[model samples]
Target: MHEVSICEALLDQLTSLAAQQGWPRLRRVWVRLGLLSGVVPDALEFAFAAMATGTPAEGAELLLENEPGHFDCAVCGELELERMDFTCPQCGGALQLLRAGRDLWLSGVEPMPS
Candidate 1:
């Protein structure tokens, strides 16, 4: 649902970047998908595939990197935990959620050389 909008926004950004950088074709897009960003990877990929037809990103590869959430346990200082895993194994303490996993962002873009 919202992934479509998100993909559309990504495409818009890619287009703008290509124009600004004078790149003719988009070769690859590297995206970091945060663990708790509430975005479905499959849906995002599907949206990209469907929307990229006849666009500059026609043959681009969408590389998705899963970014895990971070938590701060009073006893453990800081810890990296995957989605829904909020318990500290070291000291059996509940972790306070951090801001490491709440964004879906474009990390980098590789363009085809002219």
Candidate 2:
């Protein structure tokens, strides 16, 4: 699954970050997952846990935060999507994506206790 590759990339990023920041290890990792990211949370967690073995991030807590999908309607301004529908309720027009629910990124990290 691509989740394995995703975890591998994440570990690489964590390793680089720890080196750049001079941190001994990472205790936690916070990832922001969008509703449309297509990445499974359970799969990501399982992959990360497995891939983190013997690494600096081993035993680190992987926390996921959901980013709600937002859309912009020509006649309705910005609004949160409802039921994953792309139609505007007020104007019956197409809704364009504005923000959220389209990306997967690391938001924060906690360094291991000294």
- What overall lDDT goes with each candidate model? 0.86, 0.86
Indicate the TM-score of model 2.
0.77
Question: Which digits, one per residue and each the tens of the lDDT, describe model 2 over residues 1-114?
Answer: 978888998999999999899988899999988778788899999999999987789999999988778889988899885236678877899988776666688999999989
TM-score of each: 0.85, 0.77
Top candidate (lDDT)? 2
What's the distance in Å from true for residue 28, model 1? 0.8
* Tens-digit lDDT track of model 1 for 2-28: 899999999998888888988888999
Backbone clash pairs for candidate 2 read: none
Error of 2 at 53 (Å): 1.0
Clashes of 1: 0
lDDT of 2 at 102: 65
Off by more than 4 A, model 2? 72-77, 81-100
